[model samples]
Target: MVDDEDLIAERTPLPDAIGGRLREQLVFLAEVDKLKTVLRQSPLAAADRRENDAEHSWHLALMVSVLAEHSDEPIDVGRTVELVVLHDLVEIYAGDTPLYDDAGRESQQEREEAAADRLFGLLPADQAARFRGLWDEFESRGSPEARFAKAVDRVQPLLLNWLARGGTWRTPGVTADTVRARKAVIGEASTPLWTMVQELIGEGERRGWVSPGE
Candidate 1:
């Protein structure tokens, strides 16, 4: 075996700043482990249950295809698409908070904020801030782009629950009134989408595709 002095002479060292950034990147990678856990636990279909952040981003991008015609104003299709995709990147940290959980929302927000720092910190600075701004814009839901993105985000799950065999709401544990409350708000973004939601809820309920409590 080599002596201690010989081993020390051969050691490779990282510059301090470089090593620190590498540690930060590794921390960001840890969020992927949590995603594997979340996807396996289904709020929607087991097959459709994407890892929380992935699903949110996917459906929002899809909004452009599904929702373009219904926009009241001329939406910048490119900008709105970007908003949806970036909006939920923070779910990588905060986990998916179901919309109806009014009581737990405040607590969830705090956890999500912490998760944001660790997850976004992985990116080079400019990109991280750009994404963080998109997340903030989506949350505020004040602008035309933000409002549309929020609307589509809300619609994706509703459609998924209705479309998936035994969609989450179709089970006995959830209620029809819950459906009304949830989809009712979709009207804020698109009147046509809101109408489509009301009809689908009725069809699902009457056909016994959805259960009583649901």
Candidate 2:
């Protein structure tokens, strides 16, 4: 009988025009293209919906450029940008789960981990491992880059809530305290950004766009 390994190798012919790795890359990109439909922070946009994953990823890349100067510590900015871009790609499979939804957050963590495995698994082993590591690192928020990325992630939603949608705080039943609790992490990361967020939230309260603490 033929050896299993040898038989498998012989049967698995590579693509003609490009290497198997590049073929796998094309497949991965084609899969990720669906990110154009995965929406985040619903109803917060004046134009089209807040943004689908493709736009969200692009916005995160732009964030690295604008927010780099505010990093509390030195970071590998290129790596940080990579982290931001890859951070939400898993949401394509898992969907956009909000921080305020505690039940959803827990479920999302498991779903996203699985999504990362499949999505990043497309690359050759080394590149896959590196990208997956960045995704995990950003999720953990342990390193300076991850923390900075988290801060920006939080900032973006708040900006959309207030600036983009003309203080969406008016959404019924949302309290100032609830918003503050949701935003407390940004406060921990960068005081300046947190200060701006606070002012925006306060303005919403003053305008009766949102209710005071319960």
Candidate 3:
């Protein structure tokens, strides 16, 4: 009779024939599939279900394509797309933190940094370094591409909140001031987009979807 190790090996043959880089890439790809199951706080645009990190990353990448022109400083749109796509990958392990959770925000960086170390480490060394750099750049929000990516990230949830008639904003303790404080950086990237978001926030307030100032 076949032993347990033999049975396990038979069920999942090692990809020894593939080149080392390709094998590592495949492993990284399969590992990141967990991102799809990492639920976020924001609801979907078309459905009541909460969005996942993978979906959020895809949406932010698409936003970079369409909104790059609006960035206050000229930016490499491709780099911006890359930054946005990889920014939240750490969330696959760190889990999504609510924007308004003050206690969570205090420890968020530490948690996400650890998550980045683990998740990005799954890739081959060079690729892992590149991805970790992208994640750090996005966190820093210093480069034009990073700033643009951050603006798009902030805008997405605001748009979803508007679409859902205040969606997560309807939660207790969330106020117009809280949103403005949290998303103020968006104006630095695109005043026009910030203007649009402010208008939406006003509309939400008018409709009683968003609470008044704290």
Candidate 4:
């Protein structure tokens, strides 16, 4: 009988045989398939299981398209969508670092930078540079699109937690104050969304879904 390793070897093309940009594109696509396996801390709204990076990225992309009007400034929706998707591709290698993990946050940038180099390097040079550029834009939050992308990234989990009745907010030491502090950047992208966030926090505290404060 053929063993699993042998089957995998048969399915994977020899590097020398991958002769063109299309081949490189195929290889990079295969590599990013691993993103589906990278689980995140937030639970799904419609499911009992936690979400994965691929799902989170897709969700953020859709949010950008649907909520572009809410942005504090006009944004390029297409560019914002690109930022959301490229932003988390690094997590395929670096893994999801929870927002409240102090120890994890300390090394998060270093780990993600390394992951970006290795992961994006799988693509052809031009494609790699394009992907890396968008990823950096998302990280730096320098442009209007980038800031709005960052805002939606934080908002997704907040919406999920509120909907899930204290999702990650139930983590030890998390309070309404903590959520507000971390998520305040959402205001930088959209004043209306920020107001909505405040309303949600008030409601969450009243319903005992989140702690009042420290």
How many pairs of residues collide in each model? 2, 0, 0, 0
- Model 4 lDDT on a 0 to 1 scale: 0.88
TM-score for each predicted model, relative to the true structure: 0.72, 0.85, 0.92, 0.92
State, as a TM-score between 0 and 1, how close model 3 is to the true structure.
Answer: 0.92
- What's the residue-level lDDT of 97 in candidate 2? 88
Q: Pick the candidate with the highest lDDT.
A: 4
| RMSD to native, candidate 1 | 7.8
Candidate 3 local accuracy as lDDT? 0.85
**Candidate 4, 1-214: lDDT as tens digits:** 2132422233776578666887767767776888899999999999999999999999999999999999989999999998998899888768899988878999999999998998888778998999999999989999999999999999999999888999888888889999999999999999999999999988999999988886
Task: Show the lowest summed lDDT stretch of 10 residues, model 3.
Answer: 1-10
Model 4: number of backbone collisions: 0
Where model 1 places Cα greater than 4 Å from the true spot, the runs are: 1-37, 40-52, 100-103, 171-173, 211-214
* Candidate 1 C-alpha lDDT tens digits along 1-214: 2132322222443346564555444444443444434441224555644436566566669877667779765677787898887666566556677665556676987877776775666655776687777777777877777777777877787777666743666544556667777666568778888888888777777777666542
lDDT of each: 0.65, 0.75, 0.85, 0.88
Residue 138: error of model 2 in Å?
0.4
Question: Top model by TM-score, which number?
Answer: 4
Give the total clashing residue pairs for model 2. Answer: 0
In model 3, which runs have C-alpha deviations exceeding 4 angstroms? 1-13
Ranking by TM-score: 4, 3, 2, 1
Q: 50-111 in candidate 2: lDDT tens per residue?
A: 66778777877888778887776787788888888889888877888865666787788789
Name the lDDT value of residue 82 in candidate 2: 89
